[model samples]
Target: MQAWRVHRNGEPGEVMRFEETGRPVPGEGQVLLRVRAANVNFPDALLCRGQYQVRPPLPFTPGVEICGETPDGRRVLATAALPDGGFAEYAVADASALLPAPASLDDAEAAALHIGYQTGWFGLHRRARLQEGETLLVHAAAGGVGSAAVQLGKAAGATVIGVVSGPGKARTAAALGCDLVVDRRTEDIVTAVKDLTGGRGADVVYDPVGGDAYAKSVKCVAFEGRIVIVGFASGVVPAPALNHALVKNYSVLGLHWGLYAAKDPAAVLACHDELSRLVAKGVVEPLVSERVALSGAADAVQRVADGATTGRIAVLPAGAGAAR
Candidate 1:
């Protein structure tokens, strides 16, 4: 099997290398998957550089989410804390981690669905408890989790307002069913949310990009609104004042999707089933904007890290171009 491996902790492009390795064998209660496609995430780059919260040992593959199949021929999507060999022709995953992929979605889209969609779903539905008819604000609304949040927010019957960095990203957010798209580079996010919500402010703020975005989210959130902290993608993690939460009567909730998956597999399965049904029904679909070959794994990771790509980027192993 050919896989991209990080042999040392360093920059993405410098540490990651494509190499040949023997196919990984699955242990008991695990499945051997011929990886049809793998999704490149921001964490993949951070993982390669040993900057992510979870670090695998040296010479490990970085992809956390993948769509593939078990030895018994069941098509499934899987995620794990330990880095599996997802950036290759084959990988291994615990059978419990594998959820049946939606038959309606292609391999590329399936590969893209797990992490972002689950993160958004768990953040809004589980942590924030976002209600129907409420107004929701999504930061980094064109990125992977942001785009997913937009779609999920709409599906939950919320009036979704997306905040992006530029016009292109605004378009991407709009395509995902956001009612209003605000270009954060030019538009004031707080003012935009206020105006969009008729000065009531957003009922819920889904923030993946912390730092200024987090502070601004707090400012724009309505009384009794819930702000779900999903990730720190902006390279800065900000500590928002608790006094604001008290004064506004809102809550700042932290969502770690993997923890739920690890502690309560049944909840993970239930969420996956609901997400799969939504995908099959066309209510939610992964926007796989880029499809690259496995040999291009490093460049694909770079594209995500550099914020040059929109939606999801899938890495197709050799001879699997048509599958993507």
Candidate 2:
């Protein structure tokens, strides 16, 4: 088996090494998956740098989510348990964590769907309770997580306002069915949302990029509106103005999607069912911009960490892409 391993804490490209390794055997409560595709995530980079909250032991693989198959050919999506991840030809995952992949999505798409779509679904529908016909504001609207939020926000019947850093992303946001797209490089978000809603402000803000976006969300949130904190993709974690929230009567909700996997696993399964229905209807699709070979994993992870890529990147094991 061939796998990419990071033997030290550093940038992904600086440390990740590809080599032939022995296949791993799954222990109790685990399932050994024949890898089809692995989703590249920001956490993969964080793990490489020893910055993520849960760090695997030294000399481990980095991919966090994968779409794989059981020996009997059951296609499923699962978390690539740390120290041994989905970057290899095979990986091990907790049996209970696996969810049947939707028939509509291929391996790469299925791999991309697990974390980003689940986070958007949980953040918007579960935590914020985003109502239909309300306004949704999504930051970093072209990136993987933000793109998922944009699609889910629209599927929920919200009038979405997508904020992107540049023209290319603004176009991507518009294609994702954002009713209005705001280029933060040029347009003012507060003014745009205020104008779009006739001064009522946005009903919900699905912000994955925190720093400046969080700051502006405070100024544009409507009374009793909800701002769901999905992540701090901008690398600057903002301290929200609680006073502002009180004055405006809006709520600040923090969502950690992984907690649902632990506290209420059934809810996570339920969300996957809903997302699958949307997938069947073509309402939600994981935008996979690149499908790299297993050997190309390091560069893919690096591109994501540098904010130089749009949509999800999947690492397909040898012949996996062609076989599909």
Candidate 3:
């Protein structure tokens, strides 16, 4: 078996080494999966740099989510258990946590659906309770996490405002069903949202890119609105302004989607069901921009970490069903 391993903490392209290795053995309550497609996530790079919240032991694989087939021939999506992640031809995951892959989506799309879409669903519907006809602002709206929120916001009937860095991303956001697209490089996000909402400001702000995006969201968020903090992708976690939040009467909600798997597993399953229905209806789809071969896993992770790509990148193992 061939897998990419991280021996030391550093940039993903520099630290990740592709090598021939023995297939991982599943532990008790775990199952070995033949990897079909592994989704590249920002956390993969954080894992390489030893900066993620959960640090696995040294010399670990970095992929977190995968579309794979079990020994019983069941196709499912699983959160790859650490140390032996989904970057190889085969990976292991807890049997209880595997989700049946949506029949409407291919392996790459199914792999891309788990984390990002679940986070977006929980952030918008559960935490913020975003309503129909409300103005929703999404930061980094062309990137993987933000793009999911954009599509979900539209499906929820919110007027979506997508804030992206460049023209290319702005166009992508527009195509993702955003009602309005703001390029942060050349436009003022606050003014754009305020203008689009007739000066009422955005009712909900989905922020995956913190730092500056967080700062600007506060300035334009509607009174008594909700701001969901999804992640700090900007590399700088911003200090919250409690006084401003109080004055504006808006709520600041922090979402960690992974916690639901333990605290409220049923909710996670229900969300997956809804996401699958949306996929079946073509109301939402994972924007898989690149399908890279197993050998390009390191570069894919680095590109995601650098914020140089739009939507999701799926790594297909050699001779796997989704590999082209």
Candidate 4:
């Protein structure tokens, strides 16, 4: 099998090298998946640079999720711990980590599922408990997780307001069913949400971009609302203001989807099943923007790190073609 490996912590373009390796054999309770597609994630870059929360030992592959088929022919989306080798053509995964992929989605879309949608679903349904007809705000609204949040928020019956950086992203967000799109570069999120919500504020804020967005999200949250902190994509983590939380009576919830997947596999499977139903009903669709060859994995990862891609980018395994 040809796999992309990183021997040391550095930029992915400089560190990731494609090489032939022995095919892996699944141990007891594990399955050897013929990887059809794997999605590039922000953490893939961090893992390459040894900057992510979990660090693998030297010389490892760094894909966290994948969509593939088990040896017995079951199609599934699988999430793995650090040292995730989904960048390879075939990788070994524990059977417990596998969730059946919806038959309605193709391989690229299935690969795109485990991370973004799962994170969005957990944030909106579990953490925020977003109520029907409540106003929801999503930051970075064209990126993988952001776009997913927009779609899922609508499916959950929330009126979504998306915040993006430019016009193109605004259109992309709108296409995902956001009720309104705010260009953060020129508009004030607090004021926009206030106007859209009739001077009240957003009932739930799904923020993956921290830093300035976090502070502003606090300002726009309705009284007794919930703000779900999903990620720090803006490159900075914001400190929570307890005083503001107290005065507004809003709750700040941290959503770590990976932890939930690790601690409770059953819950993860249940969420996947729900997402599958949404996909079947066309209520949620995976936005796969790019499909690249396995050898182009480094470039794909770089595109995600540079913030040049709108939706998910999936890498086809060695000999695998684009998903039909």
State which candidate has the highest lDDT. 3
Candidate 3, residue 256: the lDDT equals: 95
Order of the predicted models by lDDT, top scorer first: 3, 2, 4, 1
TM-score for all models, in order of appearance: 0.96, 0.97, 0.99, 0.96
| Model 3 accuracy (lDDT, Cα) | 0.94
Write one digit per residue (lDDT tens) for candidate 2, span 112-207.
889999999999999999899999999888889989999999899999999998888788888888899999999999999999999999999998
Q: Global CA lDDT of candidate 2, please?
A: 0.90
Candidate 1: RMSD to truth: 1.4
Clashing residue pairs for model 1: none
User: lDDT per residue, candidate 1, 1-324, as tens digits?
Assistant: 798889998777888889988887778887778888888888888898788888788878877778886778777888743556588888888887788877778888987789899999999998888899999999988888898999999999999999888888888988888999999889898898998888999998998889999989888899899999888887898977888789999999998887887699898888888998898778998988888899999998887887777889998887663443
Quick one: best TM-score, which candidate? Answer: 3
Give the clash count for model 4.
0
lDDT of 4 by residue, 110-155 (tens): 8887889999999999889988999999998899989999999999
Reference-based lDDT, each prediction:
0.85, 0.90, 0.94, 0.87
In model 2, how large is the Cα lDDT of residue 177?
88
Give the range of the ten consecutive residues with the poorest summed lDDT in model 2.
315-324
Clashes of 1: 0
lDDT of 3 by residue, 150-220 (tens): 99999999999999999899899999999899999999998998888889999999999899999999999
